[model samples]
Structures are given as C-alpha cells and as structure tokens.
Target: MSRRKKTSPAEDVVDLIALLPWYVGVILALAGYLLLHRIAIAPLPSALGPGALGNAMVGTMGRGLATAGQYIVPIFCLAGAAISAWRRHARRSLMDNVARSDGPDILDDMSWREFEILVGEGFRLQGYQVAENFEAGPDDGIDLTLRKNGEKYLVQCKQWRAFKVGVPVVRELYGVMAAEGAAGGFVVTSGRFTPEAEAFASGRNLRLLDGPQLHRLLKQARGSSSAKPAADIRATEQASNAAPQAAKTAAPSCPRCAQPMVRRTARKGVNAGQEFWGCSSYPRCRGTA
Candidate 1:
C-alpha cells in the first residue's frame, strides 16, 4: 500500500477552499482577515482579579494566534481562489479544444483530473449543477455528482487510453447510485466500453458514453453555449423595443373624464407615428398625454 503524501496545514486549507467557487474563496479571505485582525488587536484582560492570570494567559495566546492567522489565512484563501480560477479556465479550454477537434484522439491527451473537469463542464453547460470529486483517486468510483430538475446523478469517468472500460466500472457506479439514492448514473470514458459494460447499462437509467460519444456531447454542449450569447442579445433587443409599447398600454385614467385611456397615435402632427394616451371617450372629453 502506498502512503498518502503529508500536506502542511496551510496547504490543506488552500485545498479545502479551492473546491469552492473563486468568489467564495475571496469572500472567505476578506472575512478571515477582518475577524482575525479584530481578535489580534483586542486588549488583554486585567490581571488583578480572581482567575485573572489564567484569563490574561488565554488572551495572550489567542491574540498571538490571531496575529499570525490574520495574514496567513487570507493568503491561503487568495491562493485557493487563484487556483480555482485557473482550473475553471483550464476546464473550459479543454472542452473547447476537444469539441473543435476532428476526432477523439485529443481526449487521450488529458490527465484524469482534466478528463473529470471536462465531464463536469459538459454537464454544467447542459444545465446541471456538477460537483467534481477532486479528492477521489482515479479508480475510487464517482468522479462527479450532477443535479438537475431536482434529481441527482452520479458520473464515473475513466481516462484509460489503452484498454476498454469494462463491466466492473459500470457495475460499481450502478451500485453506488443505488446506495446513494441517485436518480441515474453515467459512465464516461476516453476509450470504448466492453460489450458487457454496454449490456449492463442497457434498460437502466445508466448511460455509457464511449470516447466518440463523449466527443459528440462536448460538441453539442459547445454549440449550445455558443448559441446563448445570440439568444441573449435578441432577448435584450426585444425587451428594449417593448418598452415603448408597455408605456403606451399602461395608461392612467383620463384626468378630465375619469375614463380609461387608450393608446393612440399622432396621425398628422410633428409627432406623427408617436404613441400617446387618449381618453376612451374620444369625441367627448378629449384628454391626451
């Protein structure tokens, strides 16, 4: 058995925070500094009363810890934020590159972590909230947990390049899904699946994505992402154009007649084609705005 490498406390803190969004890490950094700085500068208690010596000792120790932590904690948090940002960018880049590539050969070029990131990003683009398991080893089962429309899904990623992912991996994910109450599961690989693996996934809520299928998924996700900006622009334009109509339709009661106002256009004046509120009692109490 191989022993896990020992990490310093600071490194562990950074790793823990790096699993969160970069903005969360930044918030934690600010909060940690503010709170710790307040404690670091707090005045010591008086030593002239009962148990005052112990109180003074405790205060001194607390202040000492806070003094160091004020700087150290924020530094770790910011470092984690930086790491998160870098990973975010790397994941997007990996998906983009693979989606634009001609074949699945590019998938084999990535590390296991990169493969998992790619899978998570794909699910995220498809409107799922994905939680990547960065702490899991290569063969430790589920690499990602996905949630969408109030249902949970587990994903196992196999970055094996040389051999086909077999029934055992798919079976492991299915068992985990049952035990964890997952709604479904996916087994993604950078290689083909064995016939047994495909057979096992059949007739279940499990989906097995081999290398080519994964490539196609990334491509479709990229297409959908690329279409979003155009759709958003069109929606903004529609909203802007509808503002004048909304103003015209939402007219207050006529001040002169107390009747509902109707939207009318200036027919033959300098404001021709411009809309305004006209009284519903048009030929009698003519009120215009």
Candidate 2:
C-alpha cells in the first residue's frame, strides 16, 4: 500500500470537541425558552387582596426552581450526547489505525490474540457477526465466519506481508465455500495478490480485498451515515499503478536518460496500421529500432 500519514484517535476526539459548542448553544436556547415560559405562567393576582403579597412571593420562589431545572436538564442532555458522539468517533479512529498500519512492521507489535481482536473488530464494524479463529474443518479454509442478512460468509484474513497471495489460497477458499455451502466468500489480506491469483478469483463468487482496498474499507466505515462515491478512490489507485506503463508508452527514448520513445499503433489513413520508436536524442544519436 502507498504510505500516508496516520490519523490518531486523539485527533478524532479533538474534532468531536470542536462540535460541542454548537450542541451547547442548542441546549441553552431550549433552556432559555423553558425558563421564560415558567416565569410568565407564575400566578400573580391583579387585585392585591389579603395574603396576596405572600402568595406572590411563593410564586417567585417556584419560578426560580423551574428556571434552575431548565438550565440543568439541558446541560445534562448535551453532555450525554457529546460523550456518546466522542466515544463513537474514538472507536472508529482506532479501527482505522489498525487497518492502515503496515502489517509487517506492526505484526511484531501485537500478540496473536491482539491481532485476532483487531480483525474481529474490523468485521464487526462492517456489520458482521464474526467467529474468530474458527476451526478449519476438512476442505474448509475459513479462519472466520461472518453472517449478515441471513447469509453466511466465510472469510480468511491473512496478516502476512512481504509476500503475495497465490492461487492455492484461493483454491482452498473455494473448497470451503463449496463444503459449507456458503453464500459467498471474502479473502482479506494485508498484502497484495499475484496476477495469477487475481485471475483465479475472477470467475468465482469470491471477493478479494487487498491492502489498499482494506484501508479504503476502514475509511468508509469511519465516514458518517451517508453513501460515499467509491469511484474516485478506485480511480486514484488505478491511475497510480498505471503510471509506469503510461510513461513508457508516451516518451521517446533518450540513450543517456534511458527513456523509451512515444509509440502509437495507428498513424495515418486506412492502411497505416502501426507506428513506433524514435530515439529521444534524435540527431545526436539517430537511433531507431
């Protein structure tokens, strides 16, 4: 995965803190309205008959109590909501950190049990009911089973890095899906897949989420409750990977610089079927192949 600066959970908490003032303002507004209403409704007789002064004094005291309640109640409500929002943000931030960290570098930082916990939390955030370290039965490659929408999904998570996932891994997942009659399967890895491995997965009812894809998933989970445009993220990743091929095809060769010439397969009228190769150094080298 391409390296990027990490976002901390403490930073997330700080963001939530910035929104607290708006919540406080809303609560204060409601409290002010209730306090005004209580004061307006407190009884005061137009004609000051005997004992009327005493009754008016008592009514003032009742209004004071009501005003205090108005202020205190809304303060409590705003505080509770702010706390809940902050906690949710913190949880999501921590999950994002786990998903984006370089697996090989961080693997040594966590014990096996902690690694399992992180994986389980990731699935749970995606609304899956996960069974961690599930037994591997014969022909079953599942390390975790997650059920959602009444369909069971067998998942195999590989924490391995510095390696590429290959065809046999996919083949085992296929066998497990067949044996358990799972609706579909997901293979999540902190590393990438070999081209052959990706080819093997294409026709099967399986989903492969590689390291970058996994980071994107965690980022989406951290998003607010709204649909996001996934196209941009996919496009960016594709463009980054395609840059070398694009560069090779666009430039002419410079013997000193070792850059290839711009080449085009079609150049002129009907029969001009191909075009390629002119040295970037041109007159100096006059090289063509």
Candidate 3:
C-alpha cells in the first residue's frame, strides 16, 4: 500500500483562517466582553452598590478589557464592511468570464486555474450550479461537481497537450462516478482521446469532449461572451501582464487534434527512451509529427 503524504497543520490553519471573513470578529469581540465581565468586573456589580472595591487590581483589568471590547464592535463593523467590499471586488475580477458566454480558445493560453474557471463557466451557462474542488490534490481528482434537475454530475478537466488520453484515465473517472453515485460524468480535454478510451465510454453515461467540441460549447453557452481570436489571446496576455518563462516556450502542437503536445519518453519497446511529442488524445488519436 502506498503511504499518503500528511498535510501540514500550519498550512491547514492558514487556509481555515482565510475562509473566516472579517464579520466573525464582531462575535469574537462580544464573547471576549462577556468573559472579561464575568471574570473580574461582575462580582462588584452583583453586590448591587458602588464601592471602593471596584478600584482593585482585578477590577481595573476587567474594566479595561470590557472598555476595549466596546470599541471592538465599531472597529469590527468598519473592518468587516471594507473586507466585504474587497472580497466582492476580488471575486468579480476572477469571475469576469463567468458571466460572458463567448471568449477566446480558453485552452490555448491558460493556466490550470483558468481552465477550471472555463469549465465552471461552461456548466453555469447550461444552468448547473457548479461546485469547485480546485484545491483537491492527487488523492482527490474531482475538479468540478455540478448539479441540475435533481441530479449530480462530476467533471474532470484534463488540459493535456500531449498524447491522447488513454483508457485507464477514463476508467478511473468512471470509478469516481460510481463512488459519487453521480447521475453522469464528463471528462473534458484540451486535446483528444485514444480509441480505447472512446470505446470504453461508448455505452456509458459519460461525455468526453475533445478540444474542438469544447471550443463550440464555449461559443454557444447562453450568456455569450465575445470570442477572442487565437492570435489576440497572446497579445492580450502580454499587454495585461508579463508572460512566464514557460509561456515563452512555444510548445509543439499535436498534428491530429491541433492541441499542444507534451513531451514523453517511450517506456517500453525499442523506442523506450526516445523523447517525442505524442498526441494528447493518446490512444484515441495516434497522430504524431
């Protein structure tokens, strides 16, 4: 059995903290006030009379804490409002494409994060409520879980540029579908699929989308975003931000599907160690340069 890598607790704590919005501070402050009053300030008040005892060390500390807690409310409210506004702004910035139905070839010049956004946008266009699992690691392959018509659907995005996706990948997705009891499943790729993979999906409740089909889906999505021609994509990216080193390298495309090819080495046979560009749609498309 393989050992699972343990997640770092510190990282988990940081992620948890990030999810707690600023509004929570109000409740925390209120709780602090109650605690301070009970511990040091309440005894004197419960005696039902003003007295010199209120000047005691514990009493002073409690009074100070209680006073500080009073300010926490207004401070929390202001901070919460500001944080809420900033969150809305950041969320809107990232989801700018979610409301648009047309755009460029998403896969052509996108990072993995962008690919997930594109997938969610596509499903949203179809009226499905999308739930993303972008943070899932190798242990969890679910990328997008969608719901509509009282049925659940699981989608996996594979922005593979090289080698046609093979049958095993499709099979694994099928297993996930079964485990989730999903009504159906979709395996979307920026390239194509192998023949064996296609054959396995022939009679199943699974939809396999190759690059070209995915392109059309984006174009026809209801909200209709304006499509940016492929050439403009790179230019737009350049104008918007500095391109990364990886982006500078123009990877070769798969001749069969016109999808980007990934470098691979032969693992068996005489060509085993040779590096070459394989069709990202692997077993489905054996197209090679």
lDDT by residue for model 2 (1-289), tens: 1112327544443334334544664565476668766775766666777778888778778777766766555555555456646544654555757555654345435443444455555777678887644222332456678899999988877666678888898888988898888999888777789898799889889999787776666656645222345766778889998998887666655555465654445467783776756566555655554
Clashes of each: 0, 8, 23
Report the CA-based lDDT of candidate 2 relative to the real structure: 0.64
Q: After best superposition, candidate 2 residue 33: deviation in angstroms?
A: 51
- The candidate that wins on TM-score is 1
lDDT of each: 0.88, 0.64, 0.68
Error of 2 at 145 (Å): 0.6
Off by over 4 Å in 3: 1-106, 134-136, 222-289
Question: How far out, in Å, is residue 100 in model 3?
Answer: 9.7
lDDT score at residue 19, model 3, on the 0-100 scale: 38
Candidate 1: C-alpha RMSD after superposition: 7.3
Name the TM-score of candidate 1.
Answer: 0.77
TM-score of each: 0.77, 0.41, 0.49
**Model 2 alpha-carbon miss at residue 232, Å:** 25
